[model samples]
Target: MYARPAHFYARILEAPLHFARIPDKAAISHAGRLQREKKTKELKGESDSTSKAKPWVDQDLQDDTEIPSPNQGDDEEDDPGSELDLPHVPYAPPRYAVDSMLERSRDFYTLLNQRRSVRFISPEPVPREVIDNVIRTAGTAPSGAHTEPWTFVVVSDPDTKHAIRTIVEEEEEVNYRQRMGNKWVKDLAKIRTTWVKEYLDVAPYLLLIFKQTYGIGTGGKRKTHYYNEISVSISCGMLLAALQNVGLVTVTSTPLNCGPRLRVILQRPTNEKLLMLLPIGYPSDDATVPDLKRKPLDDIMVHI
Candidate 1:
């Protein structure tokens, strides 16, 4: 213990440096994946307790409900003021003298309440401009990551509608007979909807809304879209409002077996997934809907 070898002293000096090497995130993730596979294969024979202690390897952890993202451990609080270089603008708005805002809001709510899902649509022709304007209004909805991932396909051609109806009817027949259980059949009985979808032809126009899962970039690389379901749902709601604003009645549907079949019929691109089929036109003379009441505000809302 009087004097250590030069090699031993050098090793002692390098100990802290070894620990201080900046973690290569991509390299660590790849290595971690490989190690995880090795661990999986070894787990059948032996158990290891030091798996979590390795600082160089990122742990792939999951809970019963959800998988935790890798970025969960990132210290975002360290860069509290960090932001993208976006243009700044002064806040400006004209203050209203009267209570028109509140009055208009109440009136709008009342008007929307009167709107109904019309199943029987008259085969009356509507101006193409009306559909275009309504769709434009729907497009104004906010999207996730500014990715406007919605495509509306309007179907007015008689032959296409007939084909879609035929395919949907076939699928719906199978669903009602074998796929759907007794409870489901009983639940649907109140609505009086049958496998035969004659309304497909009766409706002057069919608006098929598709949600884009991933967008293809300039190099044909697929870019992930965030919150596509939420974004499209908001857009659909706005579409309904817009349609109602123009006195057009619509009934939205998620028709059984229609999605894949419709895609083939419509010749849609791979990135889009069918979301809703809205049969839109003037309501029939005896058009009807289920007389259901909406939930009270107290039941739906929680005041904190």
Candidate 2:
């Protein structure tokens, strides 16, 4: 039997960058029944636990389901002028020899294979310029309609970091006690994670990534940022690779019920929504990671 940690179950509320555990069928069935019962009570006004709406949900929308488009209420005359009017330029990047290409690919794979999600981080200061260059590399990711809709907020101030930590911990505590069900709590017992996030303060830098849902165009018209989520996700992948290349360590976290408050505290405009939070620094001397294995190529790849 596994002992459930209330705080450990909070990850289910916000979601994670990666899901390393799969709950058993019996557990899933139990959780489904519980959710159904809760919904029934809520419908009958017999429970007030969720009397108010969750901050993350867009309450204005019906059923709190649709994410409002930026161009939804714009007048027909509010034309967002064409952004691709500029002339295209010809360019060619260097092409390597066949042998060199194979060697480089193998070396890159080896480097990335060693990358791990390290929670223990050192307080040693790192060069700011290195971080700048890594972000620059991430900015080169392809975007839909060339609308590069992403913002990276880097926080280093001790006070500000503490404030962010407080908010995350408070929300996490509430979610664990009131929101999470038993299935998720039991599933997370293997890795032993809790709501307490000391690394938010211990890491030298906190990188918060946001995705811009829309862009402001000429005459203050709103322009649709197509596939903004996918574009930002690609950039995040490049960012992780860049950090690994520079021998830095970080763990990706998506804190549930904490986005709106974090955005307000950071003073980001309403157009932006938080996507990921990463605490980055050198690994601590005694840092450890679970012994895990990647799936074989045969299991992951589908050959034609």
Candidate 3:
């Protein structure tokens, strides 16, 4: 019924001509889930000041998702009728040969492959400047409509870390004992994670990434931030990579039911929601990670 199905699949598996011509079942399912999540956030009035468009962008409509073109006419709302608006300058990024690009990618992958999320971390003091640099690197991540929607609360003081650890442990204990069902707990058994998060205070810094649901404009009025989740997620990825590049280790930790308490502790505004907590420092002397293999590329990629 099919013309050379086996040969077609073999060519797709071996060759590299077709980079992204087919969408697998997982891609479709993920897109659908993203669409639903975007809907839920909108219902909660967590909208951006820009276009009230769907949070999820279809592959074909990816360009449309961007609110403004880089060179689009003057958006300086203050002077609506000003004819002296300056146009955007030409972008002149350096071009690299394909071989050099591939080599750099491979080198990066090799470096990052050594990174592991370790629970045991050192209590040695990290310089405040290092923290500032890492968070600043995260801020450079791209965001929707250029509305960089992320706040990093760098907690270094011993007293504050202890307070955060207390609240986090309190909430986690309840989750492990009551909230987390058997299946969920069992699934976590392989990674050897528990409710006792002693590293929260052990690490030199606890960076909390908060997603700004909206912005405060002039006169304290509410303004929307676009694609908040996407923006914050990109920032977090950059945060981890920046930390790793500087020879620091970190574990991505999330505390449930502790957001309200944390907000009070950090004195954050109402529009910000805590998205992730990262404990950053040097790994303990006996730090170890599970010996695991990554999914093969052929399994994840497809061809036309």
Per-residue accuracy of model 1 over 33-84 as CA lDDT, tens digit each: 7688667858776555534434431111111212233333322222111221
Candidate 3: tens digits of C-alpha lDDT, residues 1-304: 3243223332211222122223475467667776776777778876535334432332322322233323233221221112223344457898889999999999899888777887789988888898899899999987654557799998888899999999998888777777446665555554235777889889988988888765555444444454676778888888888888888998887678787789879998766778789999988898887788888889999988
Instruction: List residue ranges in candidate 1 displaced over 4 A.
Output: 1-98, 179-193
lDDT of 2 by residue, 1-304 (tens): 3454433433222322112123465457656766776788778987747544322321122322225656556432232224443443556899999999999999999999999999999999999999999999999998755667899999999999999999998888787765356665654444235778899999999999998876677666665555677788899999999999999999988888788899999998877888899999999999999999999989999989
The TM-score between candidate 3 and the true structure equals 0.69
Off by over 4 Å in 3: 1-86, 179-193
Tell me how many clashing residue pairs each candidate has: 0, 0, 1
Q: Give each model a TM-score.
A: 0.69, 0.73, 0.69
**Candidate 1: residue 32 lDDT (0-100):** 80
Q: Select the stronger candidate by lDDT from 2 and 3.
A: 2
Name the top lDDT candidate: 2
